[model samples]
Target: MRLQGKLAIVTAAASGMGRAGVERFVREGAQVAAIDIDPAALKALAAEFEGVHTIAADLATEQGALDSIDQGVAALGGADILWAHAGMPGPASVEDLDMTAYRKAIDLNITSAALGAGRVAPHMRKRGGGSIIFTSSISGLVGSMMSPIYSAAKFGVVGLGKSLALALAADGIRVNVVCPGLADTPMKLGFTGRSGDPAEAAANEAKVVGAVPMGRLVKPGEVADAALWLASDEASFVTGVALPVDGGFTAR
Candidate 1:
């Protein structure tokens, strides 16, 4: 119950790590406003979580980001925790990448984070304090051959978190990023494009596991747990850290 009585906002919360965070936060007694672009999934989530507030909005624009936060505030009185976790994978290589795809990646992964932080920091400052968590990735810290645009965008998120941490500390707001390794999610499945071949995809995915010293892919819930800790009073003294929930992948 580390987050008991807290008000949290989780972006891209229809599925994957974002969904997991929303679920965990609610279970820990937090009032959560879950934002997602997928209307159907958002509806399902709202139905599942009796007290949860779900906002179906596209966060790639400044207005969208502002509206989402405004809705969250309206629902929960104020936001105690902000999980800016919306993102999408771009092209696999520089050669194959298009400008449109690159821009989309930046919009979803970096710009959205910047806007979300900007919106939440003010409310948190007014309240005297708050926690902000960005969903970064191993790709942010290291090179990823799988998606160059995604890596670049994630790197921007890490940078945004660090800069915001320093700037907002005086306002009693803490900002940090969590870098998750390969995890099983719809996003990952979409990245691999191997929906029809489980065996082949599993073998290809094993390559990532082999690279990790822990010899496994991190679970979505596991990353959610780390996010919960960062958003709680347990991490009161922590800020500006790019924590790797990567199962030793980054260590190697």
Candidate 2:
């Protein structure tokens, strides 16, 4: 009940961290509007939940972002919490990276977040307060050999959150970024791309485990919990922080 009666909008909510956040937000008493590009999954989610609004839209585009926000506002009465969590893992290195792919990754990961926050700010400000949570990553704080473009995009998110927090403090809006480490989610699975080889996937996953001091990948729910805190009154005085929910992955 931490978010009782609040209106929340979460992007990329069809699966992975975004999906987890939608469920968590609802359980915490928030009226949630979930957005995703997958129509089938969006339909399934809408079928599974009551009072949850699902929108199928490509957030990488301005029109898509605007439409999603407009619908969420119409559904929820107003926007109180904004979780801009849509992202794609880009190429591993500069040498092998495609320029088009890199730009698209940035659009999805960074630009989409900017648009979401920009649209929600006026509504939030009108209500006299709100919380905006950006999904950054530990990669944002450090270099990642696995995905340079993704790291850059995430890093941009952290910067965006901080800037917004400072700019909106006078208006009573709080902005913060959550930087999660390796997490066991559909997106993580996709990164490995194990072709019908469970053992190889396990081994690949194990490598991630060894890198974290906690000895295991973080769970989507764990990240959701952190997000819940950030979006709730418990973090009333907290803003402009890029918090690491990385299980000590960046401790070194």
Candidate 3:
């Protein structure tokens, strides 16, 4: 029970790393508020988990991010952990610089996390201390030729996390960021499948996988494990760190 006696609020909790984090936290003895844009997914999650409180809210807007945190804290009484994990992949090429998609990517990938953290920090302070985990990408640490917009947003997340960690450290609130690489999540698959060509998607995934020193994609559960450690007492002394669970993708 690594997270025993804790209350957590997880954004993007319907699927991918968010869902995995929720499942792992619950099993480790934490009561969680699972927030996602999909009401159907939230309902399914609530039904699957005995004590999970599910909230349907878009995390892409400032109002949505704040309101989600409010609802979660109300439902769980207070929050000891906040995992602002909602994000999206933006335009793949500089030629396709759709401002709409690019702005949405910034809002969802980094702005919401910033808003959520601002909203949740006071609650954590009231509770003595807490842990806040944000999701970045290996692209955040480096750069990406495939998606410059994505890299920009992810880099913003990392910087925001570090700033928040420093700001909240005195209050006993620890903030950290997780950088994932070539993960086998719906988001990754969707990116590769965007061309609607099976062979192309397969080939794209293969090419990306070839770059990982571990010779495989990182699993959602593996990312969850890292978040769990950051949330639990095990990482009490850790803060302001951007840990990469990329199977050595950043090692090179």
Predict model 2's lDDT versus the native: 0.89
Instruction: Give candidate 3's error at residue 138 in angstroms.
Output: 0.7
Task: Encode model 2's per-residue lDDT on 1-252: one tens digit a residue.
Answer: 899989999999988788889888999999999999999998888887787998889987889988898898888999999999899887767895688878878988999999999999999999999999999999899987777789989999999999999999999999999999888887886555526478877787788788899898888988888999999999999999999998899899
Q: Which stretches of candidate 2 lie over 4 Å from their true place?
A: 194-201
Question: Model 1 off-target regions past 4 Å?
Answer: 194-200
Candidate 1 root-mean-square deviation in Å: 1.6
Residue-wise lDDT of candidate 3 within 90-181, one digit each (tens)? 88877858888888899999999989999999999999999999999999999987778889999999999999999999999999999988
Pairs that collide, model 2:
none
**CA lDDT scores, all candidates in order:** 0.89, 0.89, 0.92
Residue clash pairs of candidate 3 = none
Residues 1-252, candidate 1, lDDT per residue (tens digit)?
888989999999989899899889999999999999999999999998889999988888778888998999899999889999999887667885688878878898999888888888888888889999999899999988877788989998899999999999998899999999988888776456535587766776878889999888889999999999999999999999999998899996
TM-score of 1: 0.95
Candidate 2 to truth, TM: 0.94
Instruction: Indicate whether candidate 1 or candidate 3 has the larger TM-score.
Output: 3
Worst 10 residues of 2 by lDDT: 189-198
Q: Per-residue error at 223 for model 2, in Å?
A: 0.6
